[model samples]
Target: MGSPLVSRGFQEFGSALQERRLRLLLAGRSGTGKSATGNSILQRKHFLSRLAATAVTRACATGSCRWASGDVEVLDTPDLFSPEVAQADPGFEERGRCYLLSAPGPHAVLLVTQLGRFTAQDLRAWRGVKALFGAGIAARTIVVFTRREDLAGGSLQQYVRDTDNRALRELVAECGGRCCAFDNRAADGEREAQVRELMGLVEELVRDQGGAPYTNDVYRLAQTLGGLSREERLRRVAERLAAHRELWPLAGFPSWAWPPCWALCCCCAFSAGTCPRR
Candidate 1:
């Protein structure tokens, strides 16, 4: 018989592969090892990775790599929550682009950060996600931590277990305690092993959420119908979507402004996981 580790890997990979198409959205700050995390998952340099003071990915970009089951796509983005961008975008203009790229909605939204470096910016990013996607989207989030090597033979779960950082604990708790870690620098098969663990978590999330992807209408309801019951919110969400479809024909953008806005948006490369691999 196969070892437990091998069996677990198979299960994890299977869970992700079961989906007709798996869409993973990676969102986080630029220097948080965000891009590298995607590269590690693909086990290739699919997204650009570097150190910079400002945001590197200014648009929403998606790259797909083949897994045994089929193609897995990862969407990377800039700081969609940045104060400058938020004032003008206000969840409508920019969000439409994200919705377009991820389509129906992403199956898993991976919030990336560095281990031991969850900063104020990180917290803001999390808040931005909830504000932008609405609080209900929290169920689909998985906190991915990069730079696993920094643990120095320690595990992030162990650190969380022992640390008194109240904010960090609450952050993880809000994510339903789902976490994944990636070394990013690992050159061996260890990378594959790490990704399998992540897929396993994705599978668990799907089961818990009854296999429903976070949809565009759900995103709309999240932003518009807060403080209402789920049933009412969903009903209103349907109405709003129906209205948009009916009115979309009459709505036209100013020729000059539309191009750049659409182009810039097409361009937030908008862009983790939890603890290190064992």
Candidate 2:
């Protein structure tokens, strides 16, 4: 292995090769506020919101957002239990399987659900998610309970402590006891706190995986990529290269040339435009 710093650069380069941006797939039941949570994280209304009874999201919707540290490529998926999606795509389960196997592959997976009712259905949904995404993903997953203000008297900790929701407790334990509550309806100091906590958790998880410490530059790059569409990213890269070309006409070449000139008694002229081999 190379030095830690060099190894980290290689890992980041590998990640970039896979896709120029880190992809996080957000998943949950319909009306669980998964989309709302996404919008909250992105700090913009990117995903479509609806107050319907059934699954509003029929397919995957992707959005990008820039953070102080990095770019976030969030894929808001349809409810795992959406009948239309399941029926339409025979490969849906396979896709879910891939996600499960590759997860935490995402820097993080935000499992959003509403507050108040921790029903058996909800428990089953959580189980399904784990079953599909795989147990490893849970280690990087955070349970973000939306509409947190619904918990009348205390913090989310107190609520969790008081509830007899065994499945929820198990889910939390499985995810390394990482949980956060968010009120997507409003912005507050708590929301910022939650984001910071999530970022810290992500950093810790990546480090535990023997990865390099997350840096501001990496995060900035991610943020820049996150805010762009596929076409836009390519376009920007092209533009940047064009600008660089203007700034440095022979950037990669050195001031020398050889061979033919060596045979022609023009060695001094060759030295003006080519590099000396090491």
Candidate 3:
């Protein structure tokens, strides 16, 4: 047997050999488990997970972890296309500051949804992603459906093909038939397997795009924002994402209720261990 220190060193060296950093933006409706998806990808409970009537994410939450041979950063945000956000807070770009949080930009934006629960709101979310990122991003996007346990003996592709929902079918087609299923409640081994499968698709996508992520005029705009001082850029991103709370009247909360809410959200991001890694 080798010395314990040498063994640890070898393990880290092995990780380095397969170390590829991937930034992924997980987008979807409020209850669709965007944060849970990020946790699943990172293989840890880094983001808050709870049952809430409104958006629990509040703002963009970023988390990262080493998965197999790759390092993945997942940016989870409040629902951009939520009719509530679009109608109430017009300033909240459906994409919000997710791109900005992703900085250099993401390798892929995984559109998350609950299995068999694709609703009108989800369609709006997809439209929001297209509106902000452009249709070209559809090619780089992957539809990730959570709650695989609900599939009932069928694969995700089969469900997509056999489902009666035209909107869901169309959305899947738009993503170039790229889709994945994850059970956030699964055991560790199973969850990691799912992450590896999704990463495999990501690798293929990276190759097809010649190692570039999807980008558009909005991405270019975000790149410009990057030139600002780090603190100022982060401040700007927070302000942009803060717009999501302006119209939470449906929650019966007063407009003045937002400042405290924003503060609490910021606290959650850091306290929940989802803050951006340096």
Candidate 4:
């Protein structure tokens, strides 16, 4: 309505209004470009994604940056579904760290994987997410395909529809028809477009859910406890947390707020909601 600078500033401000702060949890098996996807979303190389003999992400890594539209927090996790990570060691500490990093919750859970790279491990990974977060998470999830340049001339929607991989296709369908492709190697101009498109998808998801993030029973219970007296609530939370004896004395957790903190951590790990860092 005013000068060019003023108009441009207003546009950016409106975009931010359409989408404010978002917490994105990246999940997939190793080598699925989870970190790379996070880097692309941040428009920088914050998370490492180089090829390695073993898994590169041993812990849950977090990266946050302000985009033209709004702020985004990316939580990149290791292969939580792998037999080694799931059964043998389970990395409760790593999972707990990721949950704690997310804080209150996460908005959308991005199940990242390379285009045409869905395998048995990926399927297991999906199951693992369901196990931890509950069946309702599928609705709040988005299947993100990385390495889009290798898709030839085909579109991501077409690939999702035409792919012969039943499991992968079903996975996409389960997420309320939400999916996107990211060309992390694209030029600067193209990369920006891709990120913006992805943001649009995220905004649509948030809108569809009535602008509320996803949460499970554990998280809801923790929230309910917040209304109680501090001493009583902490006592109840501590009693409930006892069920997860293996996760007791959460690594790096404050000793004073162990009960509620653990409850929040568990809720964070298993919910698809935005964890407000601020």
TM-score (all chains, Cα) for each model: 0.71, 0.61, 0.73, 0.73
Candidates arranged by lDDT, highest first = 3, 4, 1, 2
lDDT for each of the candidates? 0.66, 0.55, 0.68, 0.67
Candidate 1 per-residue lDDT, tens place, 148-266, comes to 88778787788766655555678889898999888988866778778878877877786676656686554544565557775665455544444444223222223443222212221
* All-Cα superposition RMSD per candidate: 12.7, 25.6, 12.0, 12.7
Question: Which lDDT tens digits does candidate 2 get at residues 148-220?
Answer: 7776546887666656555567777787877778777765566655555555555555556554322222223
TM-score of 3: 0.73
Cα lDDT of model 4 overall?
Answer: 0.67
Q: Candidate 4, after superposition: displacement of residue 135 in Å?
A: 1.1
The alpha-carbon lDDT assigned to residue 264 of candidate 2 equals: 23
Better-scoring candidate (lDDT), 3 or 4? 3
State the weakest 10-residue window (summed lDDT) of model 3.
1-10
Residue 117, candidate 3: C-alpha displacement in angstroms: 1.0
